[model samples]
Target: METLRLQTFMVFMLSSCGFVLSFQINHLLYTQSNPTAPQTLDRNDASSILNSNFDSSLPVKFIIHGYRESGNSEWALKMKDELLVHAPMNVIVVDWQDGSSGWYFTCSANTAQVGEDTHLLISHLQTQTGLSLNNVHLIGFSLGAQVAGNTGKRNPSIARISGLDPAGPDFSGKGASDRLDPTDAQFVDVLHTDGEPLWQGGFGYYEPCGHVDFYPNGGTRQPGCGLVGEICHHMRAPAYYTESINSDCPFTAYPCTLGQESCSTCNGNCGFMGFHADKSQANEVFYVETNSESPYCRG
Candidate 1:
């Protein structure tokens, strides 16, 4: 299985040999004052953050998109909206669509620079606005999740990182320094939605790579995504996380041994999944079930 996966990864990289290109990373800030019209943030310009509506007192949330997606994508925007509704925050959408839309390998390679750029932006924000790194939370999906990991690796003081189905290709068996792992942030939580082998049509890493990992519906395929296939399963990570922002039903998850089926009981070892996941539940793996449609939490 390992050999087959490695061979598949090699083929993917070789297929994109001539597609590498420079990256253009952008940070678009949205506050309660300007929720729709995002102000562009530049790490090179201190005034970009100082002149904007960013509130240093508010917790900051950075939303990052993955391969072939932009910060302005519907899902990213929706998540920003949900987060604002939940609480006042300095929301920045990291936009790297130009780099993200190319061949998969090129996009994957671009994540390192994105992470560095983000770290620079955060450092600039702190220097200019007295923004506390402890108040910063990174929420990244797919390749963006790996980007988040990279940033956290550089800035380990970051408070929390929520990885939504981190990409598997070229990163599945990489060292912790090369991919998302528990050491990336003070607290890292991951939701695995498409963890089956690539040959089997999965798009996400299968092993636990966070302080706490949530495997919803076994983490390979999700309910209600039967017709749409792997993409649907992968996308469910963000969908479920967005709904969790203000979900009336708690995404209650119970600790379970890896590969154990029917491990549903709380047994005094449960934690809410998604946005409200408890930081105290570190180094554990949990499982939860969801509904077939929206408002997926089963409480």
Candidate 2:
């Protein structure tokens, strides 16, 4: 608990002290429709894949894994498979394990460079393949959420950004410009499944940082998640998202009044939360419930 408290306080302190963390990140692109081996690229090599197996005409999706995770994390791998299985997309997975797997504070600070690098990759893809930035979608988890938000800010033409439980400790109360936010993209959707305040052992930002924010089962404690030592709630955001990729039953949600966590009543205005999420049909502060097991969607 004390450590978590310091995470918040030290963020301010470090920023005030002008401490900067800089590093390069690995960017891997995989085409669900193409079925070739993964294309590994970085800012310096974004053009390498432009010649190999990339199709510029397809909609591009970038999945960024968060703190301590690599390109092969279960969530990233699963989400990657799901996207491929459901749609024909140019899925690019951003791997920042070199920057992300380290002291928490260092990884937190490295997000700035990670975002910058992503912007560079997108710009190169646009130049080489005529890939429209407007068709770009970025999905990030934990601190990767901040990276995506920063990328969207740097490249405003990005179509959408989905933050699966953005990291909270260093970013919980920071302004939109400093963390994941709605204005980062044309459509920003956030799934808050572990938004409990930091002192309470939560690691995901609680504020509604997206144009449409979905809270499943209060977005704090999930229905069947073991509270102690299991951040199952935080992990739920990506699992549900992965499932939404191909599930016949869509996860839908309703609006929650202020000071409310979860609302049981489903309304006509309900919006689908995951892969079926349509920015045009979105609402703020949406609440919904899901089953504890797979096929969690209530439809």
Candidate 3:
């Protein structure tokens, strides 16, 4: 009987040790995985660029790049810089480098995995800094829009998600559809520069709000080709930054300018306008309609 008692005690001690080790492993993930911001980010070192931490008060912003782009591009970097000037926030850019002509096929397969990675990144941020999930916000462009959507859907705590020129057609069907609507996200906002292509519609065939659906420049683009031109075309969508801040709520109907509609391809629904996703109040939504030929986008 004494021998059996000794064996039981040893088993309990071993189990305790295993539990302790597992906890340490998780804790280590928090400490080591958060990426450090680049030093060249801003003249102000502390706020412009930073590592992830869990201060619920500190606003956490994440930027996910689109196809054929990297986190380091001038446009992506410009958005980060602008956000710093506009708001006080910690920014992290997800880097996924897949070489293709902006329409990388493999990315579709990895959308869910990317979302999971985002969850892991946020989890680690919270664990290390002791911050709650409400402090986090995510902004994604093109295919990254799907990634952001899936991430927010899976992790309910994510405060806001903005889809900039969401790749319309590529994110269709079962695995991808669940990540597109306002209901799927806690606070979802979608901006469409060119919402014509079924396989790559800016915001897909979804409602931006119960009443107000945003149709920027009527969701169509003037003809242009080449790398620089294409980049300019995609960036012309004004709703990106506005939706980022407002988290898509209190639906407002903002029609495109006459010229914008002329060049745009209407979705053929009597809403006959474009589509937008609004989950909540939108006092912060921005609508910038500089001409399609404006230098701001061309540069």
Q: Best lDDT goes to which candidate?
A: 1
> Mind sharing the TM-score for model 3?
0.60
Query: What overall lDDT goes with each candidate model?
Result: 0.89, 0.80, 0.48
What residue pairs clash in candidate 2, if any at all? none
Candidate 2 Cα misplacement greater than 4 A, ranges: 1-24, 33-36
Q: Count the backbone clashes (under 3 Å) in each candidate.
A: 0, 0, 18
Q: What's the ranking of the predictions by TM-score, best on top?
A: 1, 2, 3
Error of 1 at 260 (Å): 2.0
* All candidates in order of lDDT, best leading: 1, 2, 3
Report the Cα lDDT for residue 175, model 2: 84
For model 1, what is the C-alpha lDDT against the true structure? 0.89
Best by TM-score: 1
TM-score of candidate 1 to 2 decimals: 0.93
Question: What would the per-residue lDDT of candidate 3 be over residues 188-293, giving only the tens digit for each residue?
Answer: 6666555543422223333242122344544445333222113444665433343333332322334333233433222332121112344433422222333334
Per-model C-alpha RMSD: 3.2, 3.9, 17.0
Worst 10 residues of 3 by lDDT: 21-30
